[model samples]
Target: MRILLVEDNQALAEGLSTILRGSGYAVDAVADGASAEAVAAAEAYDLVILDLNLPEMDGLDVLRAMRARANKAAVMILTARGTPEERVKGLDLGADDYMIKPFDISEFEARIRVLLRRQAGLRSSIVNYGGVTFDLNSRTFSSQGVTLDLPAREVALLELLFLRAGKVVSKDAIMASLTGFDDDLSANAIEQYVSRLRRRLAPHGLTVKTARGIGYYLETTAPTA
Candidate 1:
């Protein structure tokens, strides 16, 4: 899933970004609320990790603005303040969850998982589509009784497609989900990966179809051979 992390602490931001990436999340991080707001407004994100204290604008103001604009992305507030009032204010401002500074990374990750699960309207970690099953925590995929080993990028790509199965996912969106802000690769790079996946999935009666001027779609019904 794609996430926007609004944090000012350089070290903490980097560390958290790394952790989220390792967990198969595409993360874009900014040190201030304004940049965060801009990016969040412009792009599609599954969630936001917002810090209450920010340069340019306070995180609460950011949350308020997002709500005013009807941005429905889930948000989790991260800050040094653990006071009841602060937590209440954040939730009232439409924050989905809250985390205090000096928190456990494991807990933070668990909370993120919960938020994403809720967003997807699922209560479990397993995502199943077209007879393929994915274990989110283990990052493993199984189809037709065969387990396939996928690299992290492939896993992320597959998850994105599966989440929006049958919908045309643009190359730009795939790039954003795969490489985030550090994408320097050609647009056709994603096509290469999709081609590889198509070959791999052919035996399972699934295929990735390119939509010419649009993007790609994953379909369960196979073409006539």
Candidate 2:
């Protein structure tokens, strides 16, 4: 999934970004609330990890502004304050979950999973489509009881397509989610990856259809076994 992390702590942000990416998530991180607000407003993010203390604008203000604009992206507050008042305030301000600092990485990821699941209206961690089963926690794909190994970027791409199956996902959108706003990838990079993905899924009776003059779509048809 695509995530926006709004944190001023450089060390923590880098660490979390690495971990989340390794866990098959596309993460874009900013060190201030204003940048966070801008990125969140402009991009399509599956979730947002917001810090309460920020430069330019406080995280609460950012959340309030996002909600005011009817940005329905799921938000989780990351703060040092673990007090009841702080938690209540964040929730009241529209934060979905709150996590205090010095938290366990596994627990943090678990909370993120919960928020994403809730957003997708999913009750289970495993997402099934056609004959394919995707293990969100393991980042593994299995079809017809055969496991398919996919690299991290490919896995993230597949997850994005599956989450919005049948919708046209633009090349720019895919690039932004995978490479972040600061990185530069070649224009043909997404096409190359999509081509590779289509080859891989061909055996499974699924395909990534390119919408000429548009982008790509994932469709389920009879397996070509």
Output the TM-score of candidate 2: 0.91
Q: Estimate, for each residue in 168-189, the C-alpha lDDT of model 2 and write its tens digit.
A: 9887777766776666677687
TM-score of candidate 1 relative to the true fold:
0.90
Q: What clash pairs does model 1 have?
A: none
Model 2 poorest 10 in a row by lDDT: 176-185
Q: What TM-score fits each model?
A: 0.90, 0.91
lDDT of 1 by residue, 1-225 (tens): 889999999999999999998887888899998898888888888899999889999999999999999999999999998999999999998999999988998899889988988887777898777768777666677886678777777777887787778999988778776766764657777878888888777766667888898888888966334
Q: After superposition, how far is residue 33 of candidate 2 from its true place, in Å?
A: 2.2
lDDT of 1: 0.84
